[model samples]
Target chain A: MGKVKIKKKETRIDMTAMSDVTVLLLTFFMLTSTFLQKEPVTVITPPSVSEEKVPDSNLLSILVSPEGKVFLEVLGSKDSTMKSETVRADLLKNMVAEYKKTHPSANLAFTNKEMETFSKLNAFGVPITKMKEWLNLEPDLRDKFLESEQNPGIPINMNEDPNNPNEFQMWVRAAYNSMNPELQESMVKGRGIAIKADQTTPYSVVNVVMDNLQTMKMNKFTLMTALKTSED
Target chain B: MAIKSKSRQKKFDTRIDFTPMVDMNMLLITFFMLCTTMIKSQTLQIALPTNEKVEKEQQNKVKQSEAVTIIIDGKIDEKTGLSNPEDGMLYYYEGMPETDRLAQGESNMEQVEFGDKDGLYPAIRGILMKKNEEVVKRIADLKKEWKEMKFSKDEEKNDSIYQEKAKAIRNDSTLKRPVVIIKATPNASYAHVVSVLDEMQINNISRYQIDRINDVDSAMMIMVKAKNEKK
Candidate 1:
């Protein structure tokens, strides 16, 4: 009789097929899916009805701390590729210069307009002087102008057109002109600004932000919020 | 003869192995999916109405592009036990004519008044849900109606192929969105404050401009007539 021998066969799971399937699905979703981004900071928002979705490109953000300090955060701007930080640095310098002219002995004691003007920040995207107007800083701008001995034009609450006056528009135009050609190609089509504010803040601070945006002639915007609450 | 000998010895396997390439593609896709942001459709668009130099008339007629308002009047106190146990009236301007009326429930609306029997006190036109189970119930009811509305034209197209039994109770002048105007008394609580906004969402009303920012002098207050009313 012939002797019989038993041998074991391998039973390992061939991950190759599974891996291939996973890769196919990943590629499909990658090609078809859109990516949404939140602003770097969080903002508490007041309730409103309009549900306009702002696009991501060519957008800017201006931060308003609860203590009323304004931080300009520009992104995908019409001007310089590196606009916000540059613009912010320039604004602070200009504001300091303007402040020093009048309040020689005093630190910048900027007088803010009423609390309502701040809420407009999400609507308009402009520069510092226009931001001041939206914040309803009639007294501060007026005081600064009076101190510098320059004639103040009528305090126009032109919240719609922040970039209209030549002064605010010129800097923005320069920022756009200075961007690197290759980088500009990536961001040229974008058109929304995102405004992120804390909930406890009065509408006045927000208004100031929007007013500045309008003066800068930046119209489109996105207001950041936490995900909408779902029913249990 | 040498070339033939080489070919005869072995056949070369020319199928380039695709396994590793497929694995790398899957990893790349996973990374992009995690980073992608799905954008939401546009819902709210409000243009800040250019402020007119404060004119003399209390009933100042302002013109706007697609303007809306919220007039809150919550002075009724029937204290309807079925829902919303909050104090005073958190009234919503329902844009209905016959005063706050229910088509079926025990109607105590006529008995509600603001302070000294004038039929006003913060009534039930309010906002979002409250652990105020009643507030949530009302809001849900309102949301149900809004969700039923086919906002897009595609839904309307789908709806065209329907029977009379499938019709919704749409009135010709019923407000799809009521411009809420708050007329609350000075003593109204913060609940009233919340309900004004709540009612706006409940009714799917998006455009809202506070008549007066914060100061409530007679000059600051506004009145908006509800739709389908005989007042």
Candidate 2:
């Protein structure tokens, strides 16, 4: 029998097609993706059957951590960047005024650049007194400050009086007043306030937040939850 | 002509390696996957009445027969030293529990578990449905009609119809609907309260309020937990 000889073929086949497909996918994801905003604390929202998607804009998100610390995020209407900036600027001004009424000697004033930086932040929860210091920190240091155990959340006492409300209530009112009239109407119609709490957060903590809103006459709000899979 | 062709025929390899490019693409894809959130979160809308003093006239607005109170309380397990989610019991009662029974040192409070193997416990659903059968039936009928018309395709119309139906159910005086008062103990997790509220939404309950647990109610829960521990 003749010795069998097998032809040795080159192992290098074309990977150009694969690269092209992956590049296309990368582009698609990069263009359409919105990066997840870095939160001070991670929370797993409880699963629910409700299908109402959280509104993309004109939303005030109240994030409650498992440890009962509360953080807030305000996303203005998507159509106009100027409107949101204005809202943020006005919110800062109102917050300063409210802070001044409580502490006359404290300087709560911020420069325009500082106000712009604060307006651009995705989430904030530091006390008004420390807000200036928090914002002025280097980006890396700011993250460290937010993540540290020393950062107690904005003071939220049980004060129900509108005139002498808690800091949480003051922020909510400031956001409400600063937003465009249209957004305020939408909020009153139940599309504005969104509470995102950890699944393990105790009921008493949530109760306090709700009671604060109740005192402010913010009766309508939406609870943010993950979609419940059928198997669960 | 043959000599000229031979001289011109100098071949060069045109293949370029794409392994590095593919490697870069994989890295990019991984980055995108890590940074992007694929699922947009769902939202459960809730409306709570303003925190105002209940007037004497307004106190009688909810009929005794159409009232159900659900209390959620958490229990810590001794064996594992952890708060057992299963230990979170839901105590529900129709109308107010009799104080006389409490004075006699007997507890008449009824207890219901959360969801069972299949889903929401049928017994709880039965009680809720029986209490608000008329309104529930109306909501079912409207939902069926909406489905038959394929109104979901028209978002605005569907939303308006849903709003109208919810409003009508809220205002309907002829058909009595159960008014659920949800009370959670301090130890209970917010998830438990949200789950119970989700049930209210699922059962088409229009009138429900989250209230603070009172002293008598707290006493009843403690008694119930003690009884369960023995078992």
Candidate 3:
């Protein structure tokens, strides 16, 4: 049987132009786009109404990787650590201490639980209980202990603490005795903290963190936020 | 007349020309693409503690007593909400992941306030644990300083170490509940922050705040509790 070779002449699809266009598009996106792949923390921060323009470099960056590990910029680009609390604490303590000498009345302290008066605590905006935990140290006879402190407090000796788990009143007495005079003379002058949170972070995280910071007599505070990106 | 009209009649073409529609579509697409590249969104959530505005007088006194500064940085969500160190409910203390959140610290009679029941805490145990470690380290440092100082020295000098230690104890700044600074990225999640606060319960430290960097300076957001009512 003879075959009818009807349409082989005009259907030669020259995909050269298409291939060139694809390559061009790929290159364009790659060059013009910023893929922050190094971000390891995975969070969904709420929206903010702040409008601050911050520089990318020359600033201390506390990166929250998608996996939730903090990638701290301790000194500079040369030395950064993630998922290491020891390193972070060391660097932060040292830096803050240095900052404190120059700025004595700096709000650089975190708040404590149960201020010996307040009974409740909140995490984020929610109320998470730590009071019972604090009370655990107080024996069942808390009333008796309070009475003892009122009757005749323990001597201000190093070995006698009033805030210890077993003997809180005694630990409190010793803790007071351990105070340094010069710092006390200054009356714990004013200080502050600089916080930089990520965009995808949640509201509760900031709230709880704020609660922690309130303890150190660092009452004054300023919040930082990035200007929102425009959809225009 | 009818036969002559046949030559004058016009014939219409039925093929649709999509050139104008295509042009309009391309223009709209280009406009959207270009405009979208102009700015990016800053999606971050913040939960300021709900409390009666503090009196100016107390605020001033608190400001004057700038002893230790603490900061907590993290995000919040359903999972990482409400960190009660006093709560006994399993759900109440269940914090988010431990990577984020913080708690309170300590201070002196003059430097400290009586209540912060409205204060927040670590939702995650990990952050709280780290905070405890830092506080212990600070105490150790104070001990070392105490050891280094001469107890039998001149009055002014001998009293200095004691003063410093008293300040440290009074100005307890731990992340869990001592003096510590926290800087959370906005990208961190709610669960992450809550887990950190949960640790505050595990550790007995208290008093802290969330650190904020406003412009060229450092700032903070805090939780304040109502003063105890004298019944």
Candidate 4:
């Protein structure tokens, strides 16, 4: 081979198109993202063939762990007249009144700041006695408290008496009463209260929750389940 | 004059690097991926009777000929203390067991495997179809009529007609729909009970109750389990 001089070429590659594509993807994700609510205990709901989607708003979700611990999450209505903040404030007020009726000495009063914080929360399950302390904690400390094993769930005893109900039943009743009349009507028409439970939870645990709801005269409710895959 | 001309002729590079911008975008994408929940869960709607004591007269209202009872049991390993879904079993019977097969010294318990290749659903569906044959046929006819009326644009006329037909089908005294009573053992997982409830929905069953497992049912379950283990 003869010795020949080779031409020099620059190796610079254009990344303008790649950057544009990435920007588009980032914007799409950012716009559509709804952050996952931090649950005290994670549960894998059972799979079923039902196709009805859980309503995005005006919902009271009952979360049940495999250990039978229960938590409550209330998603308020998006309409201007029935905002979540107002509903939550009313619910807290009613709950305090109810609590005081049973335990006259217990101080269930919450400051405006605490009520505001409680309104913004996606899920809550601490007993009424500990709720004041829980609400007063710093945000980071509150997360730690909720995730800790010492966090006793809302007190749910197997009390089937419609007259003297458990704390869980009290919360549910408050939630139902705090809604606007229209929303309450819709709830009676089977448009509210969804139960999300772990697949491995025993039937006894679930039955207790159901019985509690029944005692409150909340006969109609929805059960949240994952979509069943074809292979299953 | 020469220095002024040289100053006027100066040029600058206009190209900008985007590596840092791309890195920032990548970080945001990751954040959103971690925080976002993409799939909305599905829901199964159910209505339960109020928690009140049913009187003896009301309890006797349900006819034995039109009743089906399903039992769910869970088997937990003694060593591991863990429940396996495969170990769960469902037993079902038609009518009252005391007067039926139990009187013949054969437990009326029929085994139903959860999610077997040809499983619990098909068998239950067959029984429901046989029991509700007249009502199902009537509902089908009403649906056909409703569809034709819709196509003919008889909106007001179709509405009342459809409602009347639906009420008749629902209240047909001669049509016998088996009342399903579901009983689960203490160890049986919630998923198994949900599966059976889903079957009722699929079969369009209207009358069903989730009741506690009685002592007799528990004894039958134990007997069935013992016999199966021996086999």
Candidate 5:
């Protein structure tokens, strides 16, 4: 048999199809997802059958830690006209004015630079007295101090009298009276204010917050919850 | 000889190895998938009564026959100071609190368990469903129609119509619907309170409010707990 010898070919796979699929998947993930915001504490909200989605903008979300610390996160109108930064800057100015009304003798003023920094923050809970000091710290240190056990958050308590408001109440008032009229409207309608607390938090801590809101006459609000998988 | 001088043309393979590109894309996809949050948080809306003290006479009194009070209590873990959702107690009473009968170790307040995981609170569900039977019956009928798309050909239109009809049925004052007042003790887990609130929605109840736990309520609870222990 005078036949030519058979040559073996390299078993190389064409990855073009795989590359195409991965690129499509990456595009989908980029388009369909939102980046997670870093918060001082992580909380697993209780599940409920309510299907109402949390509003994207013009919302004032109050985050309650298991230790009873309260933090506030504000969102402005969805459009670029009234960005969160502008609203937050205005809110800080109003808060300064509010703090002075309660403690008129105390001199508290935030510089333009400090206001800018405050506007960039997604959530804040330090006491108004320590706000300037907290703002002055490096970003990493500020976050550490916020999550630390020693940091007393926003000084909340069961104060029913709205005449002599607490720091937390003052913050609420400031947020309500901010430059964004849309936020004020939603706040009045009960859509703007949302309480996000861990499922394990004692009812008393949440009650204090509710009582405080009641005193302010901002009784209508939303409780943020995760969707329950099993619906009745 | 000139014909024999035709040059041999060399061919080159044009296929590209896309392995490197796919590897880079996979790394990016992993990063994005980890960093992104696809599921948005849901919200439950609630409206608490104003804190302003109204004149007792001006207050619209609830009919004792239609009033149902639910109080949520839970066991707190001493070590962590956290309320265990799994180990929870629910006490409910019909009509007004009978403080006079408490001395005789007899009260209208009855204790109920939150139920085990599989049942998903069958006890409380039964009680609430029994209370809102009229509305529940009507809503169930409407839901059947809604499932069949009897309201309209368009799915969205059918849904809106069903929702509107169900809401009307729930708020129908002609039916006997219980006015539930939900109260939670300080030691109760927040989840328990939410679960109770969720029960209100599931029961098709339109009139319910979250009220503060009062002294009379606590006295009754203590009496009932003592009674339960004795039993």
Candidate 6:
């Protein structure tokens, strides 16, 4: 009797099809991706059934933490000469002017380099008095300071008199006066400003921001929310 | 042409390994997937009355017969000092509040509980739906027609026509619709406020406005809370 001969088979497999699929997936992700903006505080907006989508550009979004801290983000026209960076720089200049109106003796200024750095940031909320010091810190340290407890966000309170606007109101005015007419027009129609707050935040905390806006005569604004189905 | 007998030729494999290339692409795809935000946030638009004080005669008044006020209040957790959205109270009153009878612990205001996950408060929904019965009935009939594509053969055309008709029915002045005035105390959770606003959309009531909790409202709420707790 002869022993059965064992069969030899090649062990290698082709990966070309796998590679093709992966590359196609990579292309899709790259095309449809919108990078999430970095914020000092993470807030989950309350859910609603309103179907209006937040505008991509020419918006001034206010971020309110549960602790009542506030931050401001600005975006300019999408296809205009007035880009976000340029508008941010102009806003800085206008803020400086606004601060000087109330405190003529306070010494506050930003160098061109500092302004450039500020323009690239996604959100800013430090008090105007400490803006220079905050801007001069290292990027890592600056972010820490912004999230720290000592950070008093944009000096807001219940100020009914528009003649004496609070720091938050001043920032809004500066954004409105920037060289972008589209922003101003939208603000008038009540679509330019958006309030983003945590779902668990107390109404009192949000009321302060709303009252400030109302006093500024910006009676119209939008509230940011996540989508919720009816059955939820 | 002495080719030197085509010196010993060697055959090589034609296929190249693509394992490393696929690995790199998989890594890149993971990075992009994590960095991207696929769902954009939605927005709720609201317009508040101007803060400037208006003259007594210049201020427009709502007819008392068509007014419905809803107040949202929540309890603050002692440990975290944060309001609990799940633990909240809803109070409503039709027409005007009767402060004159407050001394006797009696008022027109009544306390109500929020509905389950239905989004629309069941108790309040019944009241609002009855108040705006004419509009709701007509809108329901139109919605059925819309579902059947009665407006047009084209799907998009039918949808546009349905939307236009629904909007008209909501704004029709001839309908006896209720004016909803929403108020929230300082301790109310923001979620409750938003849910109340969402109800306006669901009920198709277009005359709702958010007003601040005045002193009179606070007093009335205290009375209602005391009355509710006693029961």
Per-residue lDDT tens digits for candidate 1, residues B1-231, read 999998798868555566676668777776887777554432222233334233213224422212233333333333421111133432232222222333222121122222222212233322212212333444455445445754334665434523221222212123232333444343343233333444444443443443433332222222221211334
In terms of lDDT, the poorest run of 10 residues in model 5 chain B is B51-60
DockQ of 6: 0.83
Name the candidate, 4 or 5, with the larger TM-score value.
Answer: 5
Report, for every candidate in turn, its global Cα lDDT versus the true structure: 0.39, 0.79, 0.33, 0.78, 0.90, 0.89
Predicted candidate 2 versus true structure: per-residue lDDT over A1-232, tens digit per residue = 9999998998898988998999999999999898998998888887777888998788889998766678888877887753666777778898887767767898778988889888887788899989988889888888888778898887896667877788898888888877477668777988889999876677777888888898888988989988875432
Q: How far is B218's C-alpha from truth in model 1 (Å)?
A: 13
Q: lDDT by residue for model 6 over B1-231, one digit each (tens)? A: 346546745568899999999999999999999999999999999988785354122224778888898999988788886777777788888888888988898888888886675455788778888998999999999999999999999999999999999999999999899889899999998888998898888889999888887787788889988988888
- Residue ranges of candidate 6 with Cα displaced over 4 Å: A1-7, B1-9, B52-60, B117-120
Assess the local accuracy of residue B159 in candidate 1 as a C-alpha lDDT between 0 and 100. 42
| Order of candidate numbers by TM-score, starting with the best | 5, 6, 2, 4, 1, 3
What residue pairs are clashing in model 4? none
**How would you class the docking of model 5?**
high
Each candidate: RMSD to true structure? 15.0, 3.8, 26.1, 4.9, 2.6, 3.0
User: Which lDDT tens digits does candidate 5 get at residues B1-231?
Assistant: 555556644567899889999999999999999999888899999998875454122224878878899999988888887777777899999888888888888889999988786427888889999999999999999999999999999999999999999999999999999989899999998888888898888899988888888899999999899889898
Better of 1 and 2 by lDDT: 2
Question: If chain B of candidate 2 is superposed on the true chain B, what is its TM-score?
Answer: 0.80
Q: What is the DockQ of each candidate?
A: 0.13, 0.62, 0.05, 0.57, 0.84, 0.83
Which is superior by TM-score, 2 or 6? 6
Report the TM-score of the second chain of model 5 against its true counterpart. Answer: 0.92
* Per-residue lDDT over A32-53 for candidate 1, one digit per residue giving the tens place of the 0 to 100 score: 7765533323444433333445
lDDT tens digits, residue span B51-143, model 3: 214422322343322223322233234464432222211111111112122233111211122112222332333333454566556655655
Clashes of 2: 0
Error of 6 at B97 (Å): 0.5
Worst 10 residues of 3 chain A by lDDT: A119-128
Q: Residues A75-193, candidate 4, lDDT per residue (tens digit)?
A: 77777788877888888888988877778898667999999999888788899889989999998899888777788788897887878878998898888788566557657866688
Better of 4 and 5 by DockQ: 5
